[model samples]
Target: MAGVFGLAEGEVKTGLRRAARLVLDTLYPPHCLACDAAVLEPGTLCGACWVGAAFQTGLSCDKCAAPLPGDPAEAPVLCDDCLRVARPWSHGRAALLYGGTGRQLVLALKYGDRHDIACPAGRWLARQAAPLCRADTLVLPVPLHRARLFHRRYNQSALLALALARELDRPALPDLLLRTRRTGIQDGLSRAARFENQQGAIAPRPRRARRIEGRHVLLVDDVMTSGATLAAAAEACFAAGADDVDVIVLARVLREE
Candidate 1:
């Protein structure tokens, strides 16, 4: 019957699906994932929420992604923190500042089971991580302790890393890194305490060492506060013989000035 309009069965089915989708969208319009405000499309934020998200823009620190306070055309600038300490990773990038809408987005994805937010967050991370992506680069996520993994039922870092791998066409090695020991929560921990808690917590899987040897690794994470976790993970990758390691995160905890 549909052949009368020159529409093949597959084409007719596709059209019907589109029509159904349109009707459904009209009935229950898409809402912002973070604020629940009505939006034109799903998996997005409303204008106010979008404006609140403090995304990192031009002229950032070369190693920490903190907004630099000098001329944009100046040589690669390092933040005071980066200059004070030698980081294990060669560089780092983050998409947003960890406050306001950014904080809401992270909390939603981290605790609310809003995995859908990973799509846009991962895309943003991919763009920020573009300078680190290369043919020989391998994407890896910060591993969660087995106990924590069991409790949470999923590793948010792994989710973001997998999404980034798809966007960059790179291989994601989630198992290459392992959390050998569980660490206490990082919340409210001082810088030195955070480092101590994460120390020796992450290690490369011995059986998968060959996969990381001599390759550039990109470490993906949900957020960077004091960066102690990423530092520990990058150190493990370096110990595993990775040529270099770079870090990328969905958000960076902005220090109060």
Candidate 2:
């Protein structure tokens, strides 16, 4: 009888806890971080918001992942900006444009500490890279400065890399590269200024580069604005003996019209 009473008490406690959680979830229901509409579950945006934020398909530039303005069947070509300034990496791609709901989602994941959002974002990135995921490739996230890591207590790029690694069954090396210097924010800077700001900013830690040598690497970042940061990272990876480096991001900022 004592054992029976204990089991009953355990069931009662479990029920109470579940009821409490339901009440809490209802009162402060998790909403879409992008559109602010109530979501069916946490870490997810509503369908409208998802549609609004997803990258447009059909025709995109092969090199930089920019949507071809009109014709869906056109061959891939660089946009005017890419034509003027040569990109440093082999190629680049992103999951969305940098405005509307997409930018807010990125901020929510980074600043709001919505790490769970990374699964969906990373799945989207994998789908984008589906045609290109090579068996021999290595996944690496862009590094944050030690100072920023201490302040934020987490790296969004690392979260994204973990997600991609799980979905693709690939190895995600979070510490393969290091950002040794913290520079000014790259926004509002000219192309040359952006380049100068990132020069010599990244280095491959000798201890971490053992597995990276002669590997095909895929560098991940949340956004690509000027391609300067990634360029710096790829340069470091190559210097550390990576045979080739390609890049993927959650978004790419096109030149404003």
Best by TM-score: 1
Q: Once model 1 is optimally superposed onto the true structure by TM-score, how far is the C-alpha of residue 124 displaced, in angstroms?
A: 0.5
lDDT of 2 by residue, 1-257 (tens): 22345667677778788888789788989777576688877667688887778584656666666766767667566677768777666767788888777888788888999887898888888887766677778899999999999999999999998898888888998988898889867878887899899999999888887777888888899988778888899889888888778888888776632
* Tens-digit lDDT track of model 1 for 17-110: 8899889889989899788689988778899999999898878887878777777688478999999978889888999989999999989888
Cα lDDT of all candidates, in order? Answer: 0.88, 0.81
Off by over 4 Å in 2: 1-30, 33-36, 40-42, 70-72
| Model 1 TM-score on a 0 to 1 scale | 0.90
In model 2, pairs of residues that clash are: none
Report the Cα lDDT for residue 176, model 2.
80
TM-score for each model: 0.90, 0.83
